[model samples]
Target: MVLRKLFRRQAEPDVQIEKGLEKTRKGVFLEITRLFDRSEIDDELFEDLEMLLIQADVGWDVSQRLVKELQDRIAAERIVNPADAREVLRLEMIQLLELATRNRKVKILQRGVPFVILVTGVNGTGKTTSIAKLAQYHQGFGRTVMLAAGDTFRAAAIDQLKVWGERLDCPVIAHQQGADPGAVVFDAMVAAHNRNVDVLIVDTAGRLHTKHNLMAELHKLRKIMQKHVPEAPQEVILVIDATTGQNGLVQANEFSKSVEITDIMISKLDSTARGGIAFSVAKELGTPISYIGTGERATDMAEFRPDTYVDSLFFGEGEGF
Candidate 1:
């Protein structure tokens, strides 16, 4: 919810994330701004506030934690005017987000074996687009990128990744529909090594008929990559649909159980008002959010910056919540 609602002007991209989070910002801050009207800070002040946070998609545990944090700050600071406590609240929420990322930068390809990222998500989560944006993002840094259409479950997924591969001017190693996904990744790894590609992004199946099967397949894919480069598959990036609200947390948890999720990419943020799922993701999974989809273009994605995000959300003057 915060880092620097130190209430300053934000950069252009910050403004875009702020705009995309408008729905969530309004929902969460409106009630918070209303609470500021109270002259006294008491236990009753936070009554039902947990529910409010949950309604904003902040998740249950973090909501309770934020409320308790507010209680502690009020007593420690001898705060009377509820308005002065807003900054305290902001700091605590920022701490939650920061704790999730732990000040670590998103992993880009480094000098070594081909840096591999395995992307996974349920169907309709915009996994493919997130992969494309990720490739474009690395290409912006001048890295040689390649894509592997390991998503043989759906014919469309293969064609879509191929389209992105062509558009980004990167090589795409793929097998025909119904081919073994792990074999696809294995061949992609060989190609990446031969070509000295800096990054190899592998797209996996969106959904499998059984959870157990999906889990096994992911393990196979990981092993296949490691066969080529022991330390490869450096990051397992999970793309989630922001509009899925709290349910997205369940998806993250389920997938994490299947494969280690090192980072997150939230897609279609601009389309949802309840983008507070970002807070829940950090609190529940403790994974750094790599990017947020702000629009449809390749550049529509924004690398998440906790401080800039908070400043942008709470920036304007006297704007009624």
Candidate 2:
């Protein structure tokens, strides 16, 4: 699908996000030419090109391998034109991203059991807002959905989810401040089951990915859910901020060790210049990104589609995927 269609009639274009991409693309294009424009493709040029990619946060190993592959392809084809070289480089980068963009759709909810999705991330990563948007998405599909404010550590968190519930007209299960998040989740499960809701999304507290104690708390929460429903918490989603760049990957790696992160939801994509990090996360971790939050609006969340994303990044103008 084209990028234009992906966002077609969805809403107004986000001006700030478009401006950010414009600036990022300018830098990326300059880097591409500066690194590849001079002289013939040689060993030294390849090494320099690799360095450029690494500096862009592509990671050292991947950059080296990509440069090698490009050199070999160019050498074997005996390509000489600079424009052709640029196109080839673009295609290769797109192909690398294609690996992660293969499957972008969310998994279908299981029958007879509410699809339970637990959202987690470090504080200030937009976890709460992502949950609200997700609820709106599911509600639009005509699915009966319930939200659980399992981040009982913060009273404001409960109120935040409640606001979303009220806006979407969906039921929300929450507790007082300092309440056990696990207990909240268990209550939510019972409520969802009784109401025969199609989905139950639980919002958890944002903790540092490096915080051992906080990570352990997540483990305990999962164990409690298992006690109530053995196969509960069917989907553990990690909400990542795209602007954090490589640091986002570090968070994903750490969180994956603590909980089985079945999928990812990248937020603030429109506001970040480092959108390529999405490809890096997928390529390095092998976890498919299910959705992306393009803006702050509730309807701005869209299913991740590789073709549309690649087109948007490289072609600069096209329909949505």
Candidate 3:
């Protein structure tokens, strides 16, 4: 059986998310959608569903749990039709994401207080670009945003951030390369505080997750942020490359070991066919995805909503899954 294509209209936000997930919807998830086109659910259906989910980069544990939940729901609800079973599966997936994100409160920037966001990730994960996108997001809210070049290990990192600052017309606080990162953070905190910047996004040097010393620097930066705002560094956003699939999960796991990751931003989402990393991150890491880098352009970003994300993965361009 094949998935059905129908003509329908989608909301603007849903349309953007659907376009961004086009690769994934046409990839492994396409197979999963076809699996539900059958007349009845069976053991073979469950097996194929579980395998397709894992192939999509949903972690092994999360895939198993989803399948088990589907089975239990089918039995308890006496669901025999494949279409009905598929709806149950959708609810389960949405519930998984909603549960993971339920505890988060909306971020509000108080007057005279700076909302600090510390971004971290391994090299080549698009951490700097994600920071730029985040700054643009805050700027959209009519809030003044400042950037801090906390990654003092590389001169190029500092220069790159300054370039972005110029493009955004936002101020960037930095020091000479190889200068103390703590000092940079301290100065940024002071500058943001005195300037009454509504939002402050700090960029850290990209390092392998296994590097202990580099991870320790994150702890020191958090301390510097605390000195200015009693509970500053309010958001620690981790950027992960979607194309890395399961390897991205490993990076998140290792980074979480060092500091509290308040949110996640999956970069290069449009480039990956396997978009299931969002599920694994939400399920395994217990971190809510705040934003997704939908495309290469700095403005090509979308605030992640669980319902929109799940729906886009299976349905798009009037296709019914």
* Alpha-carbon RMSD of each model: 6.1, 5.3, 6.8
On TM-score, the stronger of 1 and 3 is 3
Q: Write the per-residue lDDT of candidate 3 for residues 211-231, one digit (tens) a residue.
A: 887888999889889988977
The candidate maximizing TM-score is 3
Per-residue lDDT tens digits for candidate 2, residues 1-321, read 345323424332333234324434445534655655666655676667777666555676677777777877888898876556766777787787677656544466766678788899888788989988888777666678899998887788899889878866789999899887878888888888888888899998885345886787788878877775677677788998887878988988888887778778888876765566666776788777777787776667776656555555544544221
Q: Against the true structure, what is each candidate's TM-score?
A: 0.88, 0.82, 0.92
Q: What is the C-alpha lDDT of each candidate?
A: 0.79, 0.73, 0.86
Quote model 3's TM-score.
Answer: 0.92
Provide the lowest-lDDT 10-residue window in model 3: 1-10
Cα lDDT tens digits for candidate 1, 57-109: 77888889899989887888898787778778777777777866783554555
Record all residue pairs in model 3 with backbone atoms less than 3 Å apart, i.e. clashing. Answer: none
Of candidate 2, the 10-residue stretch with the lowest lDDT total is 11-20
Q: What is the lDDT of residue 199 in candidate 3?
A: 96
Off by over 4 Å in 3: 1-13, 208-210
For model 2, the superposed segments whose C-alpha errors exceed 4 Å read 1-23, 26-52, 101-106, 208-210, 227-229, 318-321
Name every residue pair that clashes in candidate 1.
none
* The candidate that achieves the highest lDDT relative to the unseen native structure: 3
